[model samples]
Target: MDSDRESNSSSSSTSSSSSTSSSSSSLSSSSSSYKMIKAKVFIWVDSELKDIYKIDEKLTWVEQKENIVTKLLPPLYKIVNKKYSITNRKLLKMLYGRWRSRHRTSNIKNQGDERVKQNKRRSSKNSRMQEKKKRRAHATNYLIENKNKYILRYPEEDLVKILKDSGYHSEEWEETDPEEEWPITQSAVVEDDEIIEEAIKQKSSSIYIHNKWWRSPALLRLLHDRIDPTVELLKKKPLTLKRKRAQSSQSRYNTSNVPPIGVPSWCLNQDALEQFNYSNVNIPVYDYNTDDQDNSDNDIEDENNNEEEIQNRTNSS
Candidate 1:
């Protein structure tokens, strides 16, 4: 009974140890799985957290230097699914700080531009477009400059137009002479060139009596500056009115009496040039000019023929 009891106890001990080892092994595996679940990082395009972001472990130096991604959101998920710490400064600089500094430098230049714009705005109140708004608000059709009193009460526009057209040159029909009218001379055509030169001066002074002056007469100067250079290039031109001059008939007579220029002495008549045959005539060819003593080979050597040439020539033994 003692030996059988001893064997029974040994087998019971072995079974208990086996059971404990199995329990420990299971607990170790569970703990490891729990740590894995805690350490896992998820990055995706949506907030539902169902998907895992595609992480590129084999990123090249060029791609890391380029730093194409610059966000920290979930929906966009501009970064990869790898976990980062602030301690990894080199990695952060390589991925983002490289390209971001370039944009920061460009923003610095824009800051300078913004400062210049502010200075200009402060210097001139009109630069902020305040005058433009006032001009727009007080705009009018300028029918005789705010007339308060008129003698006629009711004159039909058609009848007034007819009366004005008939008596355009007569000053008695209107209260003021027509300032817009000008004779069609060359000076009159270019009269709008300097129309608003003294407007700034007149604005400060009280006495500004220019009846022909209207709003924005600088536009007339601008039109003249742009039109004068390219007036000849106009494709559709009006009928040219030629003025009859006093000496025009005399000029015509003088031009008719004058001979046509650039006519050669030998080619005076076209019929003679066509009829004459050079083959039957002995035309002597002069190799040198007889008038030019220097070029003539007529018994003159070393340019010693003329007295002037003899005096100008260098002395030789």
Candidate 2:
């Protein structure tokens, strides 16, 4: 009986210990399930770190504060705003407010938002690059049209002749057959890229403003305030002015000041002055230049195209 009692007590103690361990494990697992691992973002901005709470243009004030709390580090998020001067504060507001994604893109955001932001930035960059390329191409065409106007570093046709002559014997260097296209090499690709970059920087050097400023470099001062952010700068045109009908200079000059026959001078001077300033007049003034007007019948049916594309997805699917 004494031996049985001792054996029973030992079994009971072991079972109790196991039960306690299982309960402790269950509590730990429940606590762990409630906890979540959050993702973090890291950025390396201009070598010197800035000290301020960040403001976002796209996001509201509440969202900005939330982003500051969740995205920024503890030290950065905790920084308080100081009592700035009235003028300085207003200027700062304008500076921060001038957030145009079309020209310049911001990088501050969460991981997912950053991806979308980067895509927009890339598109903007590509558009700007295309515009620059187009401008350079136009400049090059102008130079070609008036060869004597712009002085070339290499005026001789030696390079062109050599390239033309070499084209006949391209098969010698190419790995493929003469009938097939030659494979693109790394050097050829790099050279093409370098040529494009060099062409854009060759012209449109600040002609007027750069020389006008005597002592102070006024370029930085000019950039101090945003230049009408809501409205975009008009597309720059060529330097040449286009002349209309009445080829003679005297007739061209007098077209504006002289009132038409049948219209009185007093009437022309009164209401027409302000109205004609914006390409409008009380009486019809024939514009000889604009002959071809827009015909809306030529517009593409984008919705129909989209519907057709969706319906025709069977082959791919």
Candidate 3:
């Protein structure tokens, strides 16, 4: 009976020890799982936090990133996994640098394109301005060259059209007047005279003498005589009609009677005066000629004096 009791006690002790050990092992495993669930692991992709994973403390930063990338963009994950053979820190830095470089390149390209467009616009504007200047110069030269052929009053557009219609190209002909289809009439001459007179009245220096009118000496003489005297009078005495009218009206108001409208005493003629005969007139002539010998002697003396002075200066030098 004693042996039996001893053996039973030994067996019970072994069973209790085994149970305690099993319970302790279960508690340790449960604690490790709880710690892993509680611990936080942050994962980033392209500088942005993608996900927070509850992972074991044993996981490295590289593993975490790889997991994140795998979950987000699979293709990028492959590229990162294949390219990144260095440490996690170096890999992050390289990725950031690459992104920055790509963005910078794109920005530079965009700026360059914009600059090119601006340059093109500036060049086009300059070309257009140059073309306008050339056209203006050509038109001015054309007007100057054909000044004597056409009246100044003639429209530039009309002149161009007329020249084109006459089969005369502006580039082909130079400093020459084209022949006209019709002859100039007396009426046209009168019109030109009227235009010239009006231009003179307006204090204009330029005259529009048509090709046909240019041939008439009588008309030119008449215009010269009229224009010269009128211009001189205008310069010497500028008449203010308004002021004169005012003064005249005041004087008339001051007087008792109105002024007569008849001709003045200086202009009144009774037709009884004898007219002078310029055809058969005899006039006394006087001869007071200059001495050529004296003038020649004086010129010779001046020349000699100039030569002597020049010689003296040369000798001194």
Highest-lDDT candidate: 3
Please write out the lDDT profile of model 1 over residues 231-279, one tens digit for every residue. Answer: 2222134423222222323232121222123221221233332333323
- TM-score per prediction, in order, is 0.14, 0.18, 0.14
Question: What residue runs in model 1 are displaced by over 4 Å at the alpha carbon?
Answer: 1-12, 15-29, 35-54, 60-317
Each model's total of backbone clashes? 0, 0, 0
Given candidate 1, what's the lDDT at residue 25?
A: 63
Q: What are the lDDT figures for the candidates, one per model?
A: 0.30, 0.31, 0.34
For candidate 3, the per-residue lDDT at 235 reads 32
**Which stretches of candidate 3 lie above 4 Å from their native place?**
1-111, 148-317
Ranking by TM-score: 2, 3, 1
RMSD of each: 47.6, 37.8, 50.3
Worst 10 residues of 3 by lDDT: 166-175
lDDT of 2 by residue, 67-105 (tens): 444444344322211222223333333333343341233
Clashes of 2: 0
**Which number leads on TM-score?**
2
- Model 3 clash tally? 0
Full-model lDDT, candidate 1: 0.30
lDDT of 3 by residue, 75-175 (tens): 33444556333344544444444445555555555688877555554454345335333443344333333331112222333323332231111111011
